[model samples]
Structures are given as C-alpha cells and as structure tokens.
Target: MADRVTVIGWDGSPLTAAACGALGAATLVAGAAHHLALPEVPASAERIRLGSVDLAARRIAGHRGTAVVLADGDPGFFGVVRTLRGPEFGLEVEVVPAVSPVAAAFARAGMPWDDAHVVVAHPRTLRRAVNVCRAHTKVAVLTSPGAGPAELGLLMEGVHRTFVICEELGTDHEQVTVLTSDKAADHTWRDPNVVIVVGGPVGATEGGGWIAGRDPAAGPRGWTRPAQVYGGELGEGERDVLRAAQLARLGPRLGDLVWDIGCGSGAFATEAAAAGAAVIAVDLDPRSCARTEAAARRFGVQLQIVLGTAPHVLENLPEPDVVRIGGGGAAVVSAVADRRPQRIVTHAGTRDAAERVGRDLSEHGYHVECALLQSVDLDTRAWTETERSVAFLLSGELTRS
Candidate 1:
C-alpha cells in the first residue's frame, strides 16, 4: 500500500501520546501558521503554512517521506481532509481527530446541535449562509475573514435573531459572547470564530429528536396556498393563475426576501413565506394589512406586515430579492425597481397599465416582458367552477454579470 499522509486534528490542548509519536516520525508537516508554531511539532521537520493549500499539497505529494497535515477541529469535517484526499490531491491519509470547533462552540454555550444547520461563510457561500441563518431556528456558521460576525449581523438586519459568537475555541484566549443581531452588527469580531444564530432561547425551541437541522415539514413548503381566499384585487381563479406565474418568475425560496406592494389578499405573501423566504407585505389600507397578518397566522407562516403606502414604506424595510406589485401602479413599480430586486412581477387590469409598467421597468435597466393572461374557457355546467378574466402581468429582471 502507498504511504498515508497522516492528518492530525488539534483542539488547542496538549497533544495525545499517539499524535506526538506521529509528529516525531513525520518528515514533512503542513498547517496554518499558528499550528506550525505548536511545540509538539518537531523542529527538524520541514513546516508548511497553508497560506495556499494546493501549494502545500503539491509539496507533500512530491516529498519522499512521511507527511502530516495539522488541522483545527475534526480534519474529516469541513477542514482540509477532503482537499488532501480527493482526486485533485489523491493522497492516502489516516485521520486522528479531536472535538470539532462547532461542538466546542455549542458546548461553551451549553446548547444542543443535533438539529442545527451548519454552513461555511465564505466569499461565494456567505449569501446562502445568511439565508440559512434567516430561515432556520438555529444555525452554526463556520466563519471566514470577510464573511465574519459583523457581516452576518449586517445582512441579518430587520430580522430578529440572537447571536452567540465564539472565538479561539479550546484556547487560553477563548471567549464566548451572546447578543442580539442588531448589536452584533455594531461590534467588531476576532477571526477564527464560529457564530451561532438562534431565533430564540434554545430551551424554548428544542424539539428535534428524530430529524436534523429544522423539521423538513416546518421549514418551508414546496408549494404554498392561503387558508382561505378572500375576495380582493384578484378574483378566486385569477389568483391561482397569476400567483403561479409570479412565483415561477420570482423563484422565492429559503433565504430570499419577497416584498409584496399593495399585498391585496395576502395570498401571494403567504405563498412566498411558505416557500421559506421572509415576506414583507406592505399596503396603506389597515384592513388589507390585518387580513394579510391573519392569513399568515392561519397558514402557519410569518410575514412582516407594514400598514403603509409603498415607494415610502419600502425605504425602511429590508432589501428584497423579489417584489410583487398588486395594486400600486407605475410609481410603486418604479419604487421597487429602484431597490434593484433581482426580479419584479406586477399586474394590470388594463393593457395601458401593463404597457406603462413595462416602459418604466425598461427605463430602469430591467429586461422586461409582458403577458396578457385571460380565461379563454369557462365551464358553464352547474357544479363546475367557472371564471371570466383578462389581465396583464409584466415581469422584469435586472441583468447581472
């Protein structure tokens, strides 16, 4: 068999006798700068700092002697294990593990994590990580430099959550602090940190015995509907057709924010919530807002109901990934477009309104398209549902590199 590149996991504690034995025999060792400084590492052995892991792996692959990669927490976890052993490196390896930092963070807080969602907050993955934090009741973020605690806090603005930040776990400089997401944004955080985002106190939210992270059923629904359809801007059958078209274009999912301007019946708002995105339903009418809130409760979903007019109310709400214009005309559409939501879906009872919205959206740099949706057939037979409708839906999406 080929020689194995022994990967050792460290938890800032004294090295085990076996780890020490492996270190003593190793001819080449790789780790972060701090890990290379550990006294257990033999001075005679060549040290490789993982500033560039691929470089270190190349060196290890070329070395004609025993090689070991020292890593924090469990090497087999979201650490260096996969990189060193995968087809890119394809090196044989034996792992000597220690308590993972995530476990250490949860332990320091004295919270259980059997049902917690864990994510890595890196440059490419930070947005999704933040979205996970937003949607889940409990989440643990393995943070990176630019995507650290403060960034997470900022992204989490307008959403209520509790944050537990753990730094330098298992070391003398270790510290654990708990604060609200609002306050977390104001503070600077140390690197090599793990952040736990909790919706509320752990005890109140703990019920995950069989399933992991969030209960799949409770998280979000693949398809969403309101408890009961109230007659409003959209009629009974019309709502379903238009909603399907809007949802398909908007693609609201967990970790997205969908702003519904003049959220007439609250059906669209509830549906977006059911898809796991945070929803902010805005309208000037007190009755509309109340009905939306009621529908949210009945559907067992949540929505931030703002009882005010749009173009002005939207100023205070969090950024949205999608915007649905129900009643507001060109002004509302223009207001939502200014925020640069990835997609915008609006309706018009007339062709003039639709054409006007399409022109406004196009002027604002959106690739626009319009469709006239009408009921072409009606079931005249008694006991069969029938409908008559004609409406225009204009959809716009901003181009991004």
Candidate 2:
C-alpha cells in the first residue's frame, strides 16, 4: 500500500499553499516531465515520469515514503485521481483541484455552462459524441489527439455551429480561436485542447436552467399525452396503456436515440422525448409529420420528424438504441432488427404476425417477449380482461444465450 498521496491539479496557474507544502515534503513525486521541472518540486525528492496512471500507482504503492502526483486541471473531473484511488490501487489520496478545462473554455467565451453538454471524446465512442454535438445546442468536448477539433468539425459540416477551440489553456502558449465548422475542418489544431461548440442562434445557444446539462422542466410531466392537447387524433391505438407497458421494455433514458416508425401523430415520439431520450418519428403522410411536429411543440420536446416510409427511410438516419413501430408490422421489425438496437418494441395485429416476428427476432440473436394487451371499456372507464385482445406487443433484446 502506498503512503498517503497528494494529488495536485494545475491549470498553468500558481499552486495553492497546501499543494506547495505537499510537494516540498514529498519523497517520491510522480508527474509528467514538465510538472517535474517546476521550481516547487523539492531538489531532494526522487522523480517518476508519468506515462500510464496504473504504472505510477503501482510504483507508488511499494514506496515507503510520502508521494505526490501532479496532473492538469481538476484531477477529479475525468482526471488521474480516480485511477490512483481505484479498487486496483486503493491508495489513500487527498485531491487539490483547479478549474476544469471545460469551465475555463466556457469562461473565455463568456458563456454560462449550466446548460452545456460536456463530452469526453475517445477513439471508439467518438461517433456517438459527434451525434450528441449535432443534437444539442451547447456542447463542450474534451478533445484528445485523434478525436479533437479537426475530426469533429469534418462531421459537423453544414450543421450550423460555432466552434470555439481553446488550445493550451491557461498557459503562455494558449490560443483561443473561433471559426465555423468548415474552417475548423481545414485548420490544424494543437494537442491538449478543449473545444466549445454552440449551435442555434447567437444568444439562444444556452438557457437559464437549474440543472447542469438538461433542464428538468424542458418537457411534459409524464410520458402519456392528454388527448385534447394534440389538436388531432392521438392515433389508432390506445397509446397511454401501450406506453406504460413498453416503458420498462424500451428503457428510454437520456443519451439514447429512440426511433418511432410509422408514427401516426407522434404521440409516442413526443412521450419518449419528454422522458429524456432523443426521438425521431417517421411517417409517410405529410399531415402526420405536421401533427408530430405540432405535438412536439405543444409538449416542449424536441423530435426529429421524418416524412418517409420506413425500412428504406431508416437507412440514412443515425443508429438508434431503441425502436418502436406503430404501423409497419412484421417487415418493419425485420428491418429494425438488422440494425441491432439494444431494444425493440412493435405492435403485431395477429398471432401469426407475432409468432413470425418472434421467430425472426430469435434467429437474429434476440430474446423476445410477446404480450396481448388487456382492453378497458372506454365508456365504463373500467379494466376488462377478455379473449378478444386489442393489440399484441412484442419486445426484444440482444441475447448471448
């Protein structure tokens, strides 16, 4: 076990008194070369150049003397502090943090970041981060070498965004540059940087919200819609009951993209959006598209309403985490299953259709569940269980077994 470790954060700024004292007393100091070169590092202390955090932690665990780890910005915010104290190392540490890079970039831009979505880019998950930048108004991306401004700007062409690239923040070599997405794609940027992306109108990129990333009051209170508010028929099927049944199966939540195929009036799309999932409602009818947009507006939820038929229309759209089909029965299910969404929900009109869809999903490596929804007499407003089932709902998830 390592001796008590002091994790000190730097933002090209002067160290706090406690951090200075810790560095002065440290017998073993682990940090980057530049951090070790600082005047505050004691002349008598041994130095370990940091490459991998785990490696440094292991070396520190065997050292019998006090150790100090130096890092950039706030070590607690996506920094090395977690790894140093993680279950593998389990080293006792006291963190002295500085302003995070995201906060520093936003401050330089003179914008409030309470409503801004912050994404840490990685090699594998960069596409999802790009999609999030496309969907939200204000975003701050903590960029790495390959996943930095250049890569992000290339994907954001014609997306109507303002890119503020802050390089070498809080340092003498710091550069703050502002440009369109096109310029960002063409220009080269320095490493160890942060990018603040703002979309929409100049001042409308952010709002006064209580929460950090999402406004809790941005949408309706519940996932079920009131019939009279839609200004059109809430569609053919009884949505409230169906929505209640599918909520658990679909597991719609923030950061998920939910696709509604053959959306009649966008009821489920709007509900899913209000439930914190990004929703895309697809319908062939122009009237249905208008109705979906209107319902989204009425409920204050954001929905991408696509005016096209499914199976073909779904090709160009971003991959979804969940899929809900309202009209196209078995064929649509087959098309969506090919995409390998985490969850799938659709309505089947007959037993044959349900079994066929179930068998198809099973073949596609999904665990399937089917249920016939119980009907309620609308006139009596009472639940009634009968052999005459109104609609059959099927849900599927990827299965290894």
Q: Top model by lDDT, which number?
A: 2
Error of 2 at 203 (Å): 13
Quickly count the clashes in candidate 2: 0
Lowest summed lDDT window (length 10), candidate 2: 379-388
Give the distance in Å from residue 345's predicted Cα in candidate 2 to where it truly belongs.
0.6
Q: What is the lDDT of residue 269 in candidate 1?
A: 85
Off by over 4 Å in 1: 1-3, 13-21, 123-128, 200-206, 218-222, 226-238, 298-302, 375-382
| Clash count list over all predictions | 1, 0
Alpha-carbon lDDT, every model: 0.80, 0.81
Quote the positional error of residue 4 for candidate 1 in Å.
Answer: 2.9
RMSD of each: 3.7, 3.5
lDDT of 1 by residue, 317-379 (tens): 776788888876677887888889899998888777778888899898899988888754446
> Which residue pairs in model 2 clash with each other?
none
